[model samples]
Target: MNLMETIHLHKNDFSKTERKVYDYIVQNPTAIETATITKIAELCQVSTSGILRFCQVLGYKGYKDFRFDMLHYLHQEHVEVNSENLFDELTSKYLSVIRQFNNIDQNKLNQLIKQIKNTKNIYVIGVHYSSLPAKHLVLGLQDLGINTYFAYDYMQASHLYNTIHEDDLLIYFSIEGNQNNVSRFFDLTNASKNTYMITLNPKPKLLIENTLILPGYTLSKQSIVDLQSIVVIFVELLLNMFHNTLKED
Candidate 1:
């Protein structure tokens, strides 16, 4: 059983404090990657000793060992899962993804929102499965009255690139940061100072002014589903901000 399933099966065994720690751990795996016991306890509004007990329940010697094992479990799970049980996997995956997002620099997301509002047009590019997120982002932006366009195919992307202006915002979505066609689109969009990209990996060969790194292994097959879910959450958050921003206008 995966970490999530294990948690579900043994949830009744956890004390209230341990349950809080468990929920926080399952929800925020990325945070667990760099978090201290103190930090986790503070975030969960529990005591440090409570967190140590939570770790012990998971069969780890201590918090450090538990975190190490959790990371390894997530890494292994990412590689082994296929599309068959992807939905169930995502249940746990999204909890972790949202935790990562919660840890992101809100100031940076605010800056990106400012850039979006100032841009003349927004172009979103993705190919194949990655296009699923691109379309979702475009719809969210459009619903908020932002002018946005998305390209699902290389040919259409090239045509759209021709109309892109220096003031336009370019957002690229790809699970793997290195797709030939998506790379080409990045190269074309590089001429625009407003270009931005979102991918599982923040590091990309093609230069962009801004990048949103969602934690997960891009090379993993399960990563795409996880990334797509993250994108949906991001869109919802962006839309909320857009609505608030418009109200002030």
Candidate 2:
């Protein structure tokens, strides 16, 4: 259920401080995305604990979880097509994603690639829309003669753990990084040696063991089309870098 429904169902049960948080969120749903817990508390004249309690009452983990859910909710609600030069806007947005990728930490990329090169088994998994990119990446790795596998479903993906070893790697692809199923899967297979994630979420909901995070688009301007292209490009560069390192050695 969405936060609105949850709030409505439990509105009467809210404490005085929680009431303030509920009222503020109802009045300014858009503002909550970027607002810190402290800012929200100050605005409502309540403590941080109040905000936490409010989120908990609404069935969220904490303020951060509430923020992530609210951000996605607001985005879905506010999807608008700008009639002013559609082509130009799309082009600009796509370029912006690439520019964001260019600024990624080279050291982190190098380290991640090094892990990929040495890993005997590479398992790629993504949920919903993220699967498109995950498929592309797995195919590219296979072309390079890597033993890559893409998980089509949670059950099929879980089978990998039976043969999982210390030199194996799991690359998780997520757009928002808030899938409950994905988190559960990660927990069930926590014994994996290296867990890497490529995600647009700045703050992931789940933290897997030995996880290497590669952060992607910060803004939500790009559509799925743009996102797929950006992801493919990122993986292409990773493959090139891996090849270059091998050639140099």
For residues 5-106, what per-residue lDDT tens digits would candidate 2 score against the true structure? 677788898998899888877765644644568767877889999999998887789999988887776555533567887778557545544544534556
RMSD of each: 6.2, 10.2
What TM-score fits each model? 0.64, 0.60
Candidate 1 lDDT tens digits, 1-249: 876676667678889999998787666666765456777788889999999888777777898887767666666664456888877776765565566665554666787788888887889887776788789878888887889989998888888888887777887776656746555543643445566666665456555556665555422444434456666667678778877887889
TM-score of 1: 0.64
Q: Which has the greatest TM-score?
A: 1
Q: Indicate the TM-score of model 2.
A: 0.60
Off by over 4 Å in 1: 1-28, 32-73, 77-90, 184-191, 202-207, 218-226
